[model samples]
Target: MIMRQAWLSSQVLSRVEPNGQAASVWRFFAGALFPIQLGSRGVRRIKNIAYGPEGRKHLLDIYLPKGPATAPMPVLLHVHGGGWIVGSKHQQAQPLIQYMASQGWLVIDINYRLAPWNRMPVMIQDVIRAVAWTKANITSYNGDPDFVALTGGSAGGHLVALAALASNVDGLRPELGDADCTVDACIPVYGLYDLLDQNQAMEVGVGEIRSFMTRFVMPKSYSEDAALWEKISPINHISPSAPPMLILHGQHDSLADLESAKAFAESLSRISKNKVTFVDLPGQQHAYDCAYSPPAPEHARAVHRFLESVRKDKQR
Candidate 1:
C-alpha cells in the first residue's frame, strides 16, 4: 500500500505544472516522496562538463564506476532522443547508465544542438565533437579511449549511427580539429535509417512531410535536391570498414517505422564486413528502455552481453 502510494505520488508530482496547485500538492507530499534517487549507488557523476564551445547545449554528464581505479574501463557514450527537438542527457537513459556504471564502465550522456535551429549535419557535428572530446579527455576519468561504444534511441539513434558509419568524414569535423572519431561498436535503437525513403513514402498531398522538413529536418526541401537526403541518411553510408552494430527496434514503433529499422539492419548485415545483430522487441514502444518498463532490465542485459562480446573481439 505504501509503495503504491509512493508511485502515485511520483506520477502526480511529475505532471503537476508550476502554479498554486502543483506547489500545494508538492508541499503535501514533500515529506512522503520528495527525494527520489532512482539511479544506482556507487556510481560517481561528473555533471555539466563542456565538450565544445557551444555552452550548455554542448555539455555532457559522465558516470564513473565505484572503487579504486585499477585500469581504464571501456566507454559508452549515450545520446538522448526527442525527435531532434527536445531532450536532455540527464533525463533519458538514467537506468541504463546507472546499470552500466555499476558493472564497471565509464558512461557519458551528452546533450546536442536540436533541429529547426541547428539543422541536419550540425547535430551530427555536435556528436562528433563529443566523441572527439571523449577520446582526448576520457583518459583522465579512467575511460579507455580506443574502445568507445555509442547508443541512443530515436533521433539520438540516428546521430549515433551516423557518427559510427561516417566517422572522420572531413565535412563533419570541419571545425573540431583532427581527432580520431572512431567507435568500436554502435547500438542504434529505433532510428530512422533513410530520410529520403521516409519522406517519399509519406502519403501524397499530406502536409506531415512538408511540416517536418520545414520545422525540423532541414530548411531545404527534399525536392530541392534528393541526393542531399540520401547523403544524410545512414543507410547510404554503410561500408565494409564500418564497425559492429546491434540494431534494436520495437515491433510497433509508430514514430520511426519498424520496417525501416528492419530494412536498415538487413542492409548492414549484407554489406558491412562487421557483425550486425538485429533484435525486434515484441509489444514494445519507441522509448521502452527509458524508464522502469518491463523490457528495460531484459534489454539492459542484452546490451551488456553485446558490449562484452565487442570488447572480447576488440582484445583479439
Candidate 2:
C-alpha cells in the first residue's frame, strides 16, 4: 500500500477539457484517507422496484433523499460494473449511491443480465428499458426525468456511454420501439472504450477481453461477427450531441486500457459540444470509486459537482 501510494504520487495526472477539471496527483494524495463510507444517512432506500419484465435482473432500487425537496431532484441511473459477467445493481456502488443519495439526488441503481447466459445487446437493452422506466415513472419519486444522468464503472461504463452517445442505435427489442435512450450526461469510470481493436493497438489487459468476450459475451465468433463487436464499442458511437461526460480511468488499470480510455475522452471532446473531463487516476485501481479513499471520495465529489452542473443547465 505504501509502494502503491508512492507510485501514485509519481504517476497520476488528470486530463480535462473546456472546464479544465484536471485530476491532480497532488489533489489525489491531498485528501486524507477515509474509511469505506457506505450509504449516506440522509437518504431513504426503496428497494426492488421492477423496471422490466425480467424477474430479479430487471429490478432497481430508488435511493431518494428523505426530506421533502424544493422540486424534483436530478436523477442518476447507475449500471454497476463487473466486466460483462458478474455484478449487480448494488455491487460496488454503495459508496457512490450513499453519498449521492445524501446530496438530495434521486439515484436509481439497476441490475442487468450478464453474458454467457445472456448475450450482447441484452445488457444494452436492459439499460434502455431501465431508462425508459425512469423517464416514465421517476416523477412520482420526486426525480426530474428530464435531467437523467447515467454513470457506471467498467462494463457499466461502457453501457452508459453507448446508451448516451449512440443516438442512432436502433432499439434492439420490439418492446423498446421508440423508447428514448437520451441522457443529459454520463460519467464512465475505467470503462472499455474500443472493444473492436481493429488496429490491434490496445495494450495488454485488452487481449484478455478479446478471448473472454468471444467465448461468453459475444454471440458469434470474432471472425464471424467483427461488425457487432464494433457496433457495441462505445467509441464507435460518438456523435455531436453526446452528453457532458467525465471519463476517469486508473493509471494502473489492467482491465480497461488506459490509452484507449484517453483516446475515447479526447475523441468525445473533439466531436461533442458538451463539456468533457478526463481524469487519469494515479495508483488507483479500476473501480476505485467503489471504495472510500483519496481519489474515490474526491472523484465522487467531482461527479456530484458535475451532476449539479448538469442539473442546473437542464433547468435553464
Candidate 3:
C-alpha cells in the first residue's frame, strides 16, 4: 500500500504548478530524496544560443565535452515536449543530456514555438530548422554532422519522430534550400504516434485533447483536412528509408496510451528496412525523465549504447 501510495503521489505531485502548496509540499520531500544534477566533471554547458530565424523562442542549448576528442563526436538533438503548449529545453531530461555530453557526445536541447501563437507546422519547422542548423554548424562544436540522433519525451517525441520520418513533407522549412535534415537515429520516449486518433485509442482525455489540437495546433479539423492529419502523424510516414528508431513507452503511462506505442513499433517493424527497437517499461509513467531516478539513468545508458551501436554500424 505504501508503494502504491508513493507511486500515485509521485505522479500527481509532478504535475502540480510550481510555487503552489502541493508543489511546495512535493519539493520539500523530493528535493532531498532524489537530488537533481545537470552537470558532470567533463561536460560543458553553452546556453541560449539562437539557432535560426533568430526569434526569442528560436534558441537551443549545446552541451559539449570538455575533453578533446580524437575525432568529431556524434550529435544528439533533444526536443522538449509539453502537450504542444508548454515545456522548454532546460526543463526536460537535463541529466540525460549532461550524461551524453560527459560521454563525449554533443547534445543540442532545443526550444520551438508553442501552440495558439505559432500554430502547427511551425513547431515542426522550427525543429527541422534546428537540424539544418546542426548539420551546418555542429562541426564547430566537434560534432559529426552526419551522425545525428533524436530523443525527447511526449510532444518532443512526436516532433523528433516526424522530423526523421516526415522531413520530406512540404512547408517544413523552405528557406533551408537543401539543408539535409535527415537524422541517423531516433529515440522517442513515451511519444504519441497517431495524432489523428484513427483507432480511437486515446480514451483518456479525448475530448480536451482533440479540442486543443483542432483549435490551436491544427490549421483545420481532421474532418476538414484528413489528408494533412494523415501526413503529419509519424506512423503514417513509416517507410524502409526511415532512420533507425528506438521507441520507448511506459506501459502504465497515464498520458500517452501504450496502445499507440505498440502500434507504432509494429508499423515500423513491418515497413522500415532499418533497425527498430521498442521497450515497454513496466510500472513507468510519462515524462519520468523529468527527474533523475533509477530507471532514468538506466534508460540513458541504454540510449547511449544504442547510439554507439549505430555509430559502429555506420563505420563499417
Task: Give the candidate number with the greatest TM-score.
Answer: 2
Whole-model lDDT for model 2 versus the true structure?
A: 0.78
Per-residue lDDT of candidate 2, residues 1-316 (tens digit) = 8446533532333223224555555535543454455466688899999999899999999998887899888899999988788988777767678878888889999989998899998898888889889998999988988889999999999988887877447644326667676889998888988886643557775668888898889898779987778888888878888899988887788778888888788878999988888878667677767765565555666678777877677778
- The digit string of per-residue lDDT tens for model 1 on 195-233 reads 656434322323564468566767577777566566668
TM-score of each: 0.84, 0.88, 0.87
Give the RMSD in angstroms, all C-alphas superposed, for model 1.
9.4
Name the candidate, 1 or 2, with the larger TM-score value: 2
Q: Count the backbone clashes (under 3 Å) in each candidate.
A: 0, 1, 0
Candidates, ranked, lDDT: 3, 2, 1
What's model 1's lDDT at 212?
Answer: 83
Reference-based TM-score, model 3: 0.87
lDDT of 2 at 152: 92
Q: What C-alpha lDDT values do all the predictions have?
A: 0.77, 0.78, 0.79
Between prediction 2 and prediction 3, which has the larger lDDT? 3
- Candidate 1 has its poorest 10 consecutive residues by lDDT at 14-23
Off by over 4 Å in 1: 1-37, 198-210
Top lDDT model: 3
